[model samples]
Target: MPFTGKSGKFNAAIRTVEIGTGDKAVKLGGENVLPFYTFDAPIENAPKIGVLITDMGLENEVAGIKDYYAGATTFAEIAKKAEEMPGADFVVLRFEGADPNGENRSVEDCVAIAKEVGDAITAPLVIEGCKNVEKDAELFSKVAEALQGKNVLILSAREENYKAVAAAAGLAYGQKVGAESAVDINLAKQLNVLIGQLGVDQANVVMNVGSAAAGYGFEYVVSTMDRVKAAALAQGDVQLQMPIMTPVADEAWNVKEAMASEADMPEWGSQEERGIDMEVETAAAVLASGSNAVILKHPTSVATISKLIKALV
Candidate 1:
């Protein structure tokens, strides 16, 4: 039987990829076929999930997750807690200067935080720079240097920024790099081609399909990812074959269903229940979309989703 009506001979089997550096890096699930389609090929592992660690505190940060980070005043504390969580597969350290309140930290500060988080975990790490193209190039260069040969997943590369970020990963960090794009198959392929032009090996790249929340643009993200996977297996596009990353937790947290409290939105029900539901639903959507890995925040959500993946696979 075909995996998704593409009429390919090979059944979709789950594939795995390890992100980050040192002992902290983790391996996400690998299946030869599409997600939950075990009849074609048995999935050896379940989809892996990572949590995001930032340098600033999330004040009033959505009711459900507020308590989890109450003790995590800094990224260091957050990383320590995440590393302690058995269900967490990887650690994604994001430089959120894109958020004006995030201190507008310089590249030096970003490098320091990356190194600190890198040293603190056994799971693989994903180092992302602020959205500023030129600034990100400079910052990612420092991150690659500080964690050289560490096999981390450096990210936020785009059509405009791929050259600099790709070059930095190849020449400075000697680590894997992640490329991001809106939900477009051709754009994803084109970015990978540009990365190749810079001499970055295909093996060291992860593609980000740019996921959205469950109630938001999730359908678009899911359909795009499914198409990408279908093309990867049937059309033999190596760019689409690389592992996929989804910031499901981040996307879910931003939704009103997750951030709103019982007092503000009684119609939404309890904040904790709503938050977990949003996270689990978002994660479930990503799994269906063929995401190899996801970055999540809540420990409860991770646990619940892990169970769901186990049951489905």
Candidate 2:
């Protein structure tokens, strides 16, 4: 008798969330099995990667990154350089300049830059605010209106600002909404439910469920994602079935291991190498554990993770 394998495919599948438009548009989720479990079931989408660029600019970036985008002075030019990086699936525009406690940039300035990048790139765009609840509430709404027909994905409509973001970006202008939550399964599900109640289709909502550097309490990140996927697939939890998009660049690069200078800790080797390692490690772990998309900073990290996903899926 021939050996037989148990079917691991679940009855329910993760919802597909589409961002952007035309040929460059990317689809996330649409799998009924665990990540990379192609033997169980073929994945409808092979995950996706976004290159993250801050509005403030990448002045202190590593040599490799600097070399890749050499002479790209403007925001639109820089974003185009990022999107052209090998294996990049989209562009994530982070509004660090719009933070009230920091740059305190006005809504008009933010909207101007957003339109520049939005118009410049044919690739899908994801707009993430500066994490201030009030600022993001206004910033996301204004930017959403600015990039109306572009159909961008507004990252992170948290409990605090989901109402404004979901109503304007999602319902009115018809863009994808990212329902963000802290790294808790219940919190994520609840936020998703609330966003859905506002009439944003599940297919148009992606979850920014939170993340941390690898080994820096990232066990919580791993477990939370695993639980979300299991419930969504095996338990048929509709509210938890939205595709997950983790922003890995900030957390991974800001960690002590990635930031420590080679002069300070010779044993840690090059600072650039450490940062790439952290980004790649955290991203790979999250994808395997269940993220449908990831935002990475370094060009090398994005290329490496892109290859990893391509090889695995």
Candidate 3:
């Protein structure tokens, strides 16, 4: 059984740094060739999936999807459910309340949730803010300080708030930072440059290429991440070399395919299965597109995706 495309180059190759470090570390972009092509370059590490747990209950926007989790509440319950997957490498906790527009959650609340969940899990933790810039600055600052010695990824130092998030993340000792842009390659590069200017080490920075709904423009997201990785490996661009992050849960959780009632779309399958399918499909797509880390929702989805990843490895 010979493998496909460029047979056997990965006899013993470990060229790039695919994984990251924190409470839990992940490897990305180490495959010498396309996914599951055994005769090609051997894959160094399996693509990793992390589950998303919100700090507070879904408020205005996500309230409609709350039924998905049913009785589950709090990060602890989410963590317990995520552990059932067996392949989930880490957890990403988004402080939805801190968005200023959502629940207007305070910085203290964000810190408390991180402390509680970070202490309970051995997997690495990723902290994200609501879309609000001012509140994001305040909330991330506190969470960064709280996770201090704990190696966690502090997302989202944008052009608007890079200074604040970088300053705080840098002070947190082993804490790492993530830079996100909509789907622009140039913007993603610039954000990484800005974070570097802030005295944060490049090794600790992760780049977020962002994700889109299935039919709405997923190709654009996929192309941009591919381009970023190519520029890094072929052109040796330092900014593009940083690990890539994709929030599949954030995008997929709201799609009609995920939240539609089984009654409304029986042909699509059960709502639970539909939601999990959306996550697995989107995640596997990104894995092929060169994203290193993916933040996902639905415990069942994580489990399903993990199986897909194992088959690739």
TM-score of each: 0.88, 0.98, 0.84
Q: Relative to the unseen true structure, what is the C-alpha lDDT of residue 194 in candidate 1, on a scale of 0 to 100?
A: 84
In candidate 2, what are the lDDT values of residues 82-165, reduced to their tens digit? 889899999999999899999999889999999999989999999999999999999999999999998899998999999999
Task: Report clash pairs, candidate 3.
Answer: 3-39, 18-27, 18-28, 19-26, 19-27, 19-28, 20-26, 24-124
Candidate 1 on 1-313: residue-level lDDT in tens?
Answer: 8576443335433245666555546665455677677666666766787777666556645554566666776667778787666577777887876344456787777778787877776777787766677777778877888998678888778887788888988655687878888888888888888888788877677888788888896678878888888887766666677778887766787788877878999888988788778888988888888888778877788888778777877
Candidate 3: segments with Cα more than 4 A from true spot: 1-24, 28-38, 57-74, 262-269
lDDT at residue 77 of model 3 (Cα atoms): 65
Cα lDDT computed for each candidate against the true fold: 0.75, 0.93, 0.72
Q: Write the per-residue lDDT of candidate 3 for residues 207-273, one digit (tens) a residue.
A: 8868886676988988898788667755667677776778888887688887888788888877766
Runs with alpha carbons beyond 4 Å of true place in candidate 1: 1-16, 21-24, 28-30, 58-66, 69-74, 98-102
Better lDDT candidate (1, 2): 2
Question: Ten-residue segment with the worst summed lDDT in candidate 2?
Answer: 55-64
